[model samples]
Target: MSFNHPTTVLVIGGGAAGIMAAITAAREGAAATILEKNERIGRKILATGNGRCNLTNTDLHLKHYHGQNPKFAYTALTEFNYQNTIDFFANLGIMPKTETGGKVFPFSGQASSVLDVLRFEMEQRKIIVICQADINKIKKTDNNFYATCKDGRKFQANRLILAAGGKASPNLGSNGSGFSLAQSLGHHIIEPFPALVRLQLAESFLKQVQGFKFEGTAEIIVDNKAKARATGEILFTANGISGPPILQLSRKAGEYLQKQLKVWLKLSLINHLSTEQLEQILLKRWHNQPSQSLAFSFTGFIHKRIIPAMLKAAGIEDINKKVSNLSSKEIKQIASILQDWRFQVTGTDSWSAAQVTAGGVAVNEVNPQTLESKKVKGLYLAGEILDIDGDCGGYNLQWAWSSGYIAGKNAAFV
Candidate 1:
């Protein structure tokens, strides 16, 4: 337990959380070492926010997160909120800015820069970094933890911080191995699944609206109850729905489906507009182009690519029909469909397509304030390895920062 031993702290997984934990532990006068399984650190971070590196979010409330015990994040989040995250990055020489919906990113607008700051700080703090350390086994003996990598190298330290991320985007190095490592040490894992992922839908609309992108609101209804909603850019993939709003809804949709509950996606293409307003607008468009085909009438109002498909979904299949022939009933149907398009959420995209993992090491087994294991002394958990997952707009990264900060601080001094 000597702080001056120069090898007192060891952090597994050189991800967002591991990097932060190593930096803090080393700076707090403990010898810190980070063992990353990948060839490079922060690979997943480079792909976040479409390469802009959303480092944190302004919204730090518990509701923005999901877990068996979402409230478990309160202590760590309060100890190191978004303000502390901003200040920490500022101290590391990263000027940050927030975009719409409070997603915070470095002023450089490059995820590489975020990694750069973290790497630079780690180097300045003299934190030992070992990349390509694909650890497979961790054991606790006496008062020390020993880690054995698949490559036969061994790591030993007085304290161990498991910041290894969950199984999401395996190419980025989260291959679910961390769960095995934690489970080996008496940690209960709550079946890990994909989060912040796109949902696959029936080909009926997907094939027709593929590649069509728009701004809209998406709601997740579980067992006929609205669970969550988000308003942002929505994109129709060749096989499913995507974009921020859809991604925000996908987590809950997948969770409910896992529990055998009925889940559906309710989308409002004409967000913020009432049914009356939408109907009036549709009527005006038809009146202005009385002789135009149904397709032609909606051309200027909606994307031409989606007009036919939308009309078809609304049960108005004749695209060649003249707008002037539309009765009040047809007009109302179009408006209603526009405002309340429903789709069955078959399932979420694979883990490779997910931005985060929803379930991991259960929360109740860890200390809320320090993130230390209640089952084993000198062991801690942080980041996606814990059960907590957050919204797509940088809330996940914020959780990493908060939990890593708490775990690192306590690991070094405790």
Candidate 2:
């Protein structure tokens, strides 16, 4: 049932941040209410970590995040950091296991478990939750705020926290509507773009390297200057590239594309060996396999599916050419192909494919310590709706948890 009385703390959006905010307020003995648009809460949380839910990471530094003002994260994170998050979940009866790179997941290995904990906490705290209430407009009064739903449900509160997420994973309910809501309330909305998404390359390069999964570095260069670089497993799809490394830099690639600038992908497919060491290895291999065909010589080292494309890119048409006939220059040419492969990034995948959205309300406008708006009083902001986007790890979720806690804690005390 909808909340019939005045809400002391009204938190919008039922995802990670909103729920946490409501919980914090209710636990502090405030009348807290959450208005969620989805059929239920935590739809996006269920999709995190491929259903395992990477809750938080141990390796958190300013380098792992990007925005107009990355320093804003320091205050919120300092107030409630990684260990606090681990303890927060632990108190909820969840035992978390850490994987490589400090990614923490529940021992149960289900996102539903995390969501259930959140549900259980809300029930315990007696926080009023109204689902399927699509917020249409938010208005501010001299004393309080009023959130009007499209279904004619109006909620009044002394304080309002807008945790509506960014324009990513629209199927999961973040359709960028939060931007408009903030803009309507006399707040500036920064231009939003797709982040942590796959990149579509030039058709020719994709056709040659489709389905090639390898470990290496992917660099996004704009106007001949390197913008961002990441190292991880990069997988090529039929049309583009996905995987941690590519998705890490795709946001910058998309931003540069919109500026009508040249963006190129410089890849180092094999990272372990130096260029000289790779050339030396190639020289010895060519000498040792003098009688084998060019195609046969690469059989042991490279996959059969990728050899043709690699050979073709190296300008070697004669796959059957005997190794003895291959010159030192030809071997070096093949080695260079592996070390330095470049492709022009045409664009990034749309919001439907992106994991997060880059750019939102400017960080400087929000008080990082309290997550309250500097311009709009009693209106706190959290989650992906802000001008903050973290890397592929658990940084985003950490921001949601920390910011939600701060906003919730203060929204009640205010």
Candidate 3:
């Protein structure tokens, strides 16, 4: 059968990374074509940062990223650091605003604005963009590669860049199709799991606590040992727990939960106070208001909506009993509960709710400097499809920018 003639480069997947790669290639004088399986390009990108798109973190460190080889990101990150990302966007006409914690959002705080700029850039560069095209086959010949879509359309290129994202947001068009493509091309893939997803618990009381939001610290313990911890806003849901703190712990939670290990969360409703310190602080309050009931005394320490639940958890015999009547041991128990309330994690909310996928193409198979495949020449990988995943905030987005930039620059050179 006759096939399409080879072009300079063929970049598959039109999400964040794919678009960036395509734009980079075209700007370097290479004819680039992007084949997207979705109806529109960058659908997943428009859903990022709660629709505002936290494009990159101004302050990024190696600690923020999680992977089998954490150091694998060192080269790409340095080559296209946060400042480079800021400059890239600033040149694209999208003014980014730094919010609390170095999280950068578009000045309009709309994810669409970021997408629009990328779209405009790709258009100006005159890159060929075809949507609603699903890649069915990829074959490497002696000198180049051939990609055939399910629609029987064939594309040939000297270099291929796979920016098809991970399986996290299938509704946004990343449904593990990229993994299938990579495996077909002889790549070893790490088992993909949901990351940055809300957790589900077996506790029955969560139904009553659903919809309640609290500011607290959550410590993730594996087999009763403290493995990791984070402090942020926690939200109780009908099914389980969510919010920033829970999402921060989800990457580890998802991994350990798969091993059938006991994953527990020690939630501190109060921040930075040790159990002993809390006990002493509460004792002072009790002595200062001897006639006030313990329930009345704790109103200032906790949210009014959760005070009754806190009292119940502490096993206070009388809500109306004066604090002065409470024994020393009883007051300490209340402080302990506030300082170290714990919950068990049963599972995650699933890929639909996951912000980023945990695992993808193993980093060892791809060169970090250029994001090129070690097993195959003229092939590259980037974005969430790689095994690298970052913590909450703008870490994941930063990876997208860095990896995309490297892949694009290298693909054009090839």
The candidates, ranked best first by lDDT, are 1, 2, 3
**TM-score for each model:** 0.95, 0.94, 0.92
Which candidate should be chosen as best, given TM-score against the real structure?
A: 1
Model 3 TM-score? 0.92
Write candidate 2's Cα lDDT for 221-297 as tens digits: 87788898989888988888888989889878877887888889987877889999988777788888789888888
Cα RMSDs, all models: 1.8, 2.8, 3.1
Clashing pairs in 2: none
Reference-based lDDT, residue 381, model 1: 95
Once fitted onto the true fold, the runs of candidate 3 whose alpha carbons sit more than 4 angstroms away are 1-7, 284-297, 315-325
Cα lDDT computed for each candidate against the true fold:
0.89, 0.87, 0.87
**Taking the tens digit of each residue's C-alpha lDDT, what string does model 1 give over 99-185?**
988889999999998899899888899898999999999999998999999989999998999999999999788999999999999
Cα miss at 339, model 3 (Å)? 0.5
Give lDDT tens digits, candidate 3, residues 1-414.
112332488889998888888888777777889999999999988888889999899778898998889799989899999999989999998898999999998898989989889989888988899998899899999868999999899988889999899999788887999999999999989899999989998776777778888888898988789888888889989899999989999999988886778898888898787777878888888888899987889877777667766777778868778988997777767888887777788899988899999888999999988899999999999899999999988898888888888888888864
For this target, which candidate reaches the highest lDDT against the unseen true structure?
A: 1
| By TM-score: ranked, best first | 1, 2, 3
